[model samples]
Target: MKNEELRIKKSGFWLLASGFWLLASGFWLLASGFYILASGFWLLASGFWLLPPTFILHYPLLIIHC
Candidate 1:
């Protein structure tokens, strides 16, 4: 009877550990996903900032060539 109780306790401990691991991993994934999304927005903003210099440099060159 004691052995049976010991097995039940062991299984319960493993179940709790696995549950905690899954929760931790899920939170980590969510945090990384948010970080990636934020970086993507930053990249888009940087691209916008870069556009005017490109237009200024190219348009006159095209007109001069033509």
Candidate 2:
């Protein structure tokens, strides 16, 4: 009887730990996804102005080497 009770308690502890772990991981993933989505929208909104400096001219790389 005592061994059975100990086994139940151990199992309960692991179940609770796993539940919290899953919730935390889910929340972290959700928040990270939201951030990336927002960043993508912001870049898209400013893409015309942002594009030349970021990719077109490569001016920064040239300046760095010079």
Candidate 3:
């Protein structure tokens, strides 16, 4: 249970962090008009670093509000 909780937290953190990165990259791409490089960063920030361990580790990713 403890390990599961930890994994969940880590996944959530990564999800949020990557989401922010994705948003920032998108904004930068628009502001600077840099499509190619910014698109690469956007793709990576969207899922490349956020999806693998979150799903492959068998931890169900969920959002709960308190």
Each model's lDDT? 0.94, 0.89, 0.80
Q: TM-score for candidate 3, please give it.
A: 0.49
Question: What's the distance in Å from true for residue 5, model 3?
Answer: 0.3
- Model 2 off-target regions past 4 Å? 48-66
TM-score between model 2 and native: 0.67
Model 1 spans with C-alpha error above 4 angstroms: 53-66
1-66 per-residue lDDT for model 2 (tens digits): 999999999999999999999999999999999999999998876875766655646766888889
lDDT of model number 3? 0.80
Candidate 1: C-alpha lDDT: 0.94
How well does candidate 3 score on lDDT at residue 57? 53
Each candidate's number of clashing pairs is 0, 0, 0
Which residue segments of model 3 deviate by more than 4 Å?
Answer: 34-66
TM-score pick, better of 2 and 3? 2
Which pairs of residues collide in model 2?
none
TM-score of 1: 0.75
Backbone clash pairs in model 2 (N, Cα, C under 3 Å; residues 3+ apart or in different chains), count: 0
Query: Of the candidates shown, which would achieve the greatest lDDT relative to the real structure?
Result: 1
Model 1, position 37: C-alpha lDDT score = 100
